[model samples]
Target chain A: MATRVQAAPFDLAAELAGFGQGPKVGAVVTFTGVVRDDSGTLRHMEIEHYPGMTERAIAAIEAEAAARWNLVDSLIVHRYGKLAPGEAIMMVATAAPHRGDAFAAAEYLMDYLKSRAPFWKKEFTAEGAEWVAAKSDDESALTRW
Target chain B: MIDVLYFAWVRERIGLPKERLATSAATVAELVAELRSREDRYAAAFADLDALRVALDQELSSFDAPLAGVREVAFFPPMTGG
Candidate 1:
């Protein structure tokens, strides 16, 4: 189990090294979120987070996901600060004995991280900057679990 | 004294990140009320309670929750993290 909140970019390859290698682990699922510029006018994206609460909240979510699934290992690494378009924002990796458990646990971690985490995103476009609003769909997604 | 923090637009509008305040407000709502009464900046930042979320002692909490032993209170908009 590992949770890292940093401003520096993380290498997906380095993060996955030796991951999900235990004898009982058969399935490993990974998800990565990238900074996208759909409008083609974005200058950058700035991410703000409550330092103390951010770590605590994410660790709690990870703990919950572990409790809900049979897992061998899990990792969550999120980035804060300015990120250019196409930059990797964050990633989650889950390893379990079966594909079903790995997939479900990864999804569960994402759904909770979307709304429960303390990070906030603001987009700087050609015209101005605006804070990204939380989506109602993201909140409702939690009801599925 | 309790540490009060504002984030995102709440921090921008209020023009600061955090402050230590001595208050007798019994709940989060009352603390908000007291801040709102301070000046235009606080009032404007807290004009709509629906747009804001609060945390007590770093844990997400409701505005009606008591402030008995909370050492930190944070106010911010809904999270957009993933």
Candidate 2:
């Protein structure tokens, strides 16, 4: 298991190269979040995170996923700082002995990461910049777990 | 002294990223009360406790959590990470 929090972009191909190759690992799942300009007025996004808390919070969520699923391996990579639209924001990968476990663990990790992590996003637009508000749907999604 | 950090709109509203404060407040709620009493910016930023979240020593914590031996405190809105 690994968790990386950095300002630099990550290579998706390189990260998945040797993901889960062991005999015990039969399935692998990955999810990537990208910066979207749905409104077309977005210029860039600024992702602010608590320097010391972000990593710790992600690690804790990763641990919970591991305990809940039969995960053979797991990885979470999140980026911070200013990013343009179309850039990748974060990614999560999970490997398990079966497809069910791998898929479920990946979704669980995403639900927790969305609300529990200590990172915030601000969108810069032609008009101005505004902090993104936490969605009630995201919070409600956690109740399923 | 406790290191107080703010993020996102909270930092923007308060016009600061971090500060070191010498406070006699015993819990997160008391510390917030002390800060809210200081200036209009703080009062505005901390006006709605329900809209804000607090962390003690970089860990998510409740407002009533004790401040004894805690070196850091942070206040911000609910996270919107993914």
Candidate 3:
């Protein structure tokens, strides 16, 4: 049960080294998001987050996922500040006794993080910078759970 | 005085990140109305309420929520996190 909001990059191998180590734990699921330069003009992506509220919101979402999925352990690491294409933006990992629980919990965490978190992204391109807008499809995805 | 924060395009339009103001508005909507009346920039930023979101004391809340004891209020565009 951990949530980290930082500007520094995280090491995935180091993060997963000790994941799901408990005796009953049988599955560990991980998802990593990276900055994509889909338009081929991006210089960097600036991520801004509400300083005091981002962590709390993520923690609350993680708690909900834990309770709903009976998770053995979970972790969420989200980065702020500027990032280049191919850089890791964030990651979520879940540990559970069964693969279904682990997978579902990881997916749930990602879905909630997409819209409920207080972070915003602004992409800097060769032309200029523009703020990213929330996608209606992302909000609709929440109806599944 | 209550602290008012803005983010994303809201901050860009408002030309600042945060401000401390003395407000007597009863709810988030009233505060918004007051701000909207103050200047053209605020009016432009808050022109479309449906395109914006509000947070009270750092927690996501509704526009109609009361501001009885809230020390902070944040306004921003819809979140685009992941």
Candidate 4:
């Protein structure tokens, strides 16, 4: 498992392909999160994450997933710095011997990351900027794991 | 002593991204209370506990959990960390 925190866009296809070692690992689940334009409702969004802590936190999540699943490879690419609409913001890929493991692990990582990781997102709208309210649904998702 | 970190909205409210602190708190909740007592900034930052999340030594954990032997305690907005 690997987690890269950088200011540049990542190549998700290449990342997932790298895990293609032996033929036994047949499944690959990839997720790409892109910046979406919320019309004028959202002018822009600011993402804040702990510098040293972001990497450490992400690695811990990956490690937990690796231990719980039969995964062969996993990659988490999260971008920082100023970003615009339609830009790639983050990606997650999981490879395993079976699709079920790969798919579930990838989804699990994403849901948990959204709810448990230490990142804050502030949205800029027509009126002004505001922190998106944390939802109860997100916390409930953690119980699924 | 531990390196305490704040991220996202927590940083915005606290006006700092990171800080170091020596504490007597035995649990994360106690630390949060300690921070809230420090100054107006910390009080404002930690005002809404429901909107906050915590990590001990970089691993997400409950606020009531012990932090006696931890190396770090991180406070942040409910994560959008993907």
Candidate 5:
């Protein structure tokens, strides 16, 4: 398992090049989140995170997924800093002997990362910038696990 | 001394990112109360307890949790990360 908190953009292809390369690995699941300009006026987004806590929280989330799922490998890469529309925000990958475990663990990591992680987002637009509020749906997603 | 941190709007509202203060408060709630009484900026930042989340030494915690051994305390709105 691996977790990374960085300010630099990650190459998805490069990240998955040798990921989950194991004889027993049968399935791999990956998810990527990107910035979107839903309001049309969005210029960019600024992501802020607690340096020490961000790494610790992601590590703890990864450990929890490992404990709950039978997997061969897993990786979480989340980025912070200025990102324009369509820029990748984060990605999660999971590998397991079965598709079910890989899929479920990937989803679990996302749900926990949404609410448990320390990162916050600020949207910049032509008009102004505003901090993104936590969604009730995001918090409720944790109940699934 | 405890290092107090504010993030996002809390940081913006308070006009600073962090500070070191010697506090005698025993719980997170008491710390909030003390900060709220300090100035209008702090009061505005902590006006609604329900809107905030607290962390002790980088670990998620409750406002009622004891602060006996915590070296750092952070206050911010609910996380919106993914």
Candidate 6:
């Protein structure tokens, strides 16, 4: 598995392909989250994370995914630093013997990540910059899985 | 002794990004209460405890968690990072 937290842009195609290997693994599912322009409603976003804790959180989430799913491999790439609208923010890919595990693990990983990760976003909006709040729905996603 | 960090609005509220603190408290909640007494900046930052998230040694943790064996502590807004 590959997990990266960097400032440079990532190649989803390369990442998905790199994670796909062996005839036993027939399905690979990936999710990419990007910063949307939102028609200028959001000027820019500042992503804040604790250097060491952010990684540890990601690793813990990945470990949880591995335990609950029949996954062959996984790649979680999350970028930090200032990001503009329409830029890729993060991606999660899972490979498994079947599409069921791959998709389930992919969603499970994202759901756990959204609710538990140690990162924050400050949005520069027309009203002013504000720290985004935790959404109940996002937190609720973890309950189903 | 522990290195504490604040991020985003939490940092803005505390008027600092980082600081080294010496404390006898055993849990994150105690440490926050101590800082809240230092000044209004800290009080405002920690006013809504539920909205904020805490990390011990760079891992997500609860407020009641002990500080024993901890080297770092961080507080920040809930995650919006995708």
Candidate 6 Cα deviation (angstroms), residue A14? 2.2
Clashing pairs in 1: none
lDDT of 1 by residue, B1-82 (tens): 9999999999999999999999999999999999999999999999999999999989999999999999999999999998
Among all windows of 10 consecutive residues in model 2 chain B, the one with the lowest summed lDDT is B51-60
Q: In model 2, which regions exceed 4 Å deviation?
A: none
The 10-residue segment of model 5 chain A with minimum total lDDT is: A136-145
Distance from true location, Cα of A1 in model 2, Å: 0.7
Q: After superposition, how far is residue B11 of candidate 6 from its true place, in Å?
A: 1.1
> What is the clash tally of candidate 5?
0
Provide the lowest-lDDT 10-residue window in model 5 chain B: B73-82
lDDT of 3 at B20: 97
| Per-residue lDDT over A14-129 for candidate 1, one digit per residue giving the tens place of the 0 to 100 score | 99997898799999999999999999999999999999999999999999999999999999999999999999999999999999999999999999999999999999998999
DockQ of all models, two decimals each = 0.93, 0.93, 0.91, 0.67, 0.92, 0.75
lDDT of 3 by residue, A52-113 (tens): 89998999999999889978999999999999999999999999999999999999999999
RMSD of each: 0.6, 0.7, 0.6, 2.4, 0.6, 1.5
Candidates' lDDT values, in order?
Answer: 0.97, 0.96, 0.95, 0.81, 0.96, 0.85
TM-score of chain A of 6: 0.93
Which is better, 4 or 6, measured by DockQ?
6
What is the DockQ score, from 0 to 1, of model 3? 0.91
Report residue B21 deviation for candidate 4 (angstroms): 3.4
- State TM-scores per candidate: 0.99, 0.98, 0.99, 0.85, 0.99, 0.94
Residue-by-residue lDDT tens digits, candidate 4, B2-78 = 88888777887899877889999999889999999989999998888877778887777888999888998888777
- For model 6, the docking class works out as medium
User: Over 4 Å off in model 5, which ranges?
Assistant: none
